[model samples]
Target: MSVSPQDVEKVALLARLAISESDLPEVTERFGRVLGLVDELNTIDTETVVPMSNPHDMHQRLRPDAVTRQNDRENLMASAPAQDQGYFLVPKVID
Candidate 1:
């Protein structure tokens, strides 16, 4: 698929991008190339290919879940400007 300068301009406007007049041609050309690649991909037969979460068949390496730090809420809350009921209090910014 080919992309026109008008299409590029419309896309830029929709995306809230500022594309200079001088840069429009290059931008349009690049967009055309990307669309062409997508068009090429559409011609491939993928009826037998199953969708997968990952490209490779492998399980992710995971670490055993364990407590890495001791809870020191009392010591940390002591330095706060204001706190109540196990929660830090801050100035209300919104009504």
Candidate 2:
């Protein structure tokens, strides 16, 4: 897949990018290389390839879900400037 300078300019405009005229050629060349890589990947056969969430076949080790700390809400809330009904009160910024 070949990319022209005009195509890069159009893409830059659409993406709101500030690519200068001096850099346009370089950018276009790089973009063309990326598309070339994609084109190369398209030639690879993957009909027999199996889709997987992970490459490893091992199960994830998980820790037991248990409460490790006591509830200290009242102690923490004591330092708040204003709180009501177990909820911190904040000054309304919008009318």
Candidate 3:
């Protein structure tokens, strides 16, 4: 899992990092170790494992999508800073 200086330089170019030549060796070593850890993880046994999106298995309860009457237009408009006719008025942004 040892990484060469050239490999580090290529990674730097791809990532747009400005790593110096002297620092390439250390960066390569660190990056190689990280990749080695991932390689080790790939060797773990999980053939019969089930994939999970979340820990909880309970589903959300859904209600009927029916509309209900709520005739309170004046109460709704009371919260607006400015209103004209039946629409809320705001500062003009376009010419």
Candidate 4:
């Protein structure tokens, strides 16, 4: 769980952080504390604990899947500036 100055430097490089030489000792100590906490958590017994997808046991209510709107494509296409074969046409802007 102990973190070295080099490890802190590597972490800073990976995170794209601008860490000064003076800050290395403090950063390394903080990282060491975090690693120690994680190491402590690994010692807990979870053999009887069940994994959960959600904290609460509940099912989501869903409405029946059915089309509710009438087909109005013909009325909609009449307002388009330019349309061809049921698709709106536009000028090519890219090569």
Candidate 5:
């Protein structure tokens, strides 16, 4: 599980990265170690394990779906430039 300097150079070219000649060796070594760790993880048997949506067992609390407030129409109409029948009026944008 190792990547060559040529492999790293080709990858850098494809990824649009500017890697110097000196950095190629370090990048190749790092990528090889990453591939090795991935190889190690491939040894695990997860066929019998149950998939989880979250690591911690927690649920969100929600309020009851009921009306809890009412709008003060007179107070709201006072702030508008023009209002008619408890509604704010705006300039017509289209016919």
Candidate 6:
């Protein structure tokens, strides 16, 4: 679980990060601290904890789904440069 300088270097390379030699030790120490925190958290027991989508026990109020706009397909399609059989046409992009 301990993070070494080599481990930090490898992680930096994999993540495409630029870490100078002078900062490698500091970066390794910080990474080790993060891992230690994770290890500490892993020791806690949560078998009795209930899974929840939100911390607050409340239901979201949603408006009823209803159509509010009139259909104007023909008027919209009239502005298109190219269209065919009620469908807008575009130049062929792939073979």
Q: Candidate 6 local accuracy as lDDT?
A: 0.92
| Candidate 2: tens digits of C-alpha lDDT, residues 1-95 | 99999999989899999999899889999999999999998899988988667989877999899989998999999999999999999997797
**Ranked candidates (TM-score, high to low):** 1, 4, 6, 2, 3, 5
Candidate 4's residue-wise lDDT over 17-52, tens digit each?
988988888888999999999999889987898876
TM-score of each: 0.51, 0.48, 0.48, 0.51, 0.47, 0.49
Please name the candidate that would achieve the greatest lDDT relative to the true structure: 1
- Model 5 poorest 10 in a row by lDDT: 71-80
- Candidate 3 lDDT, 1-95, residue by residue in tens: 67788888887899999998778778888999998999898899878888767789977789888878677889999999999999899999797
CA lDDT, every prediction?
A: 0.93, 0.93, 0.87, 0.89, 0.87, 0.92
| Candidate 3 whole-model C-alpha lDDT, 0 to 1 | 0.87
The lowest-lDDT stretch of 10 consecutive residues in candidate 3 is 45-54
| Model 2 poorest ten-residue lDDT run | 50-59
lDDT of 2: 0.93
**Where does model 5 exceed 4 Å of error?**
48-95
Clashing residue pairs in candidate 2 are none
Model 2 / residue 11 / CA error / Å: 1.0
Please identify which of the two predictions, 3 or 4, would achieve the higher lDDT against the true structure. Answer: 4
Clashing pairs in 1: none
How many collisions between residues are there in candidate 3?
A: 0
